[model samples]
Target: MEIAQNYLDSIRFEFERYKTMGDATFAQLDDSDILWRYNDLDNSISQIVKHLSGNMLSRWTNFLTEDGEKPWRHRDTEFEDPFTTKAAMIAAWEKGWQCLFEALSLVNPDNFDTVIKIRNEDHTLVAAFNRQLAHYAGHVGQIVLMGKMIKGEKWVSLSIPKGQSEAFNTKKFNK
Candidate 1:
């Protein structure tokens, strides 16, 4: 039981970390920056965000009780950008994370052993968590990388800045 509780706690932390990383990346970009893509085939930050939000809404709503992939979700359509500005993109991002965190908060030791379904496929709760974590983390990486590219030398590092690892580790060791 303690292990289940700990796992839930850690998973929540991981989700929040990913969300924070994306938020930090967004903070450095302008409105037009969010919509920039390398090519027509590449997805812009807005497109990635829309897809993430749609996936979160479908997968987290009534999560354990219903299929994670809701019938109403048009996965392809998520690539379409409805956001014209950074604020709109941020709103969607926050709403999606809200749904995810709310659903996660409901998971406890009692239900941790149950299986959840996504697209009619069975998944242990741990598997579901790992799945979403990987998906979101990948998108967050894209957001950060693109934001860096858009900002060039002006981009601020979310983690340790380049060439500062020695200083970072020294501070850590001293602590």
Candidate 2:
């Protein structure tokens, strides 16, 4: 039981960390920046966020009970930008995260072994969490990369700054 709880706690912490990274990147972006794309082949931050939120909502809504890929979800449409304002986009993002967290709250050690379904495929709860965590992290990486590109030299470092790793390590070791 302790082990199961610990695992869930670790997963939650990782999800929160990734979400924070995305939030920080969003803060550095302007409304226009969120919609900027390199080319027709590329996706803008808004589209990525839309797709992420859509996936979150689908996968986490009735997480333990229903298929992660909901029948009502139109995945292709997620790539089409629907938000005209940054606030709206962020709201949707928050909604999706909220759904995920709420679903996660329902999971306890007793049910840790419950099977989850995604597109008719069976997944243990841990496997499902791992899968989504990887997916979300990948998208957040894209967001952070786009934010850096859009901000150029003005981009704030989310981790140790480019040449400051030495200083960061020094401070860490001295503590």
RMSD of candidates 1 onward, in order? 0.9, 0.9
Residues 30-141 of candidate 1 have per-residue lDDT tens digits of 8999999999899999999999999999999999899999999999999975577999999999999999999998999999999999999999999999999999999999
Q: Report the C-alpha lDDT of model 2 over 58-86, residue by residue, as the tens digit.
A: 99998888999999999999988567689
Off by over 4 Å in 1: none
Candidate 1 total steric clashes:
0
Itemize residue pairs with steric clashes in candidate 1: none
TM-score of each: 0.97, 0.97
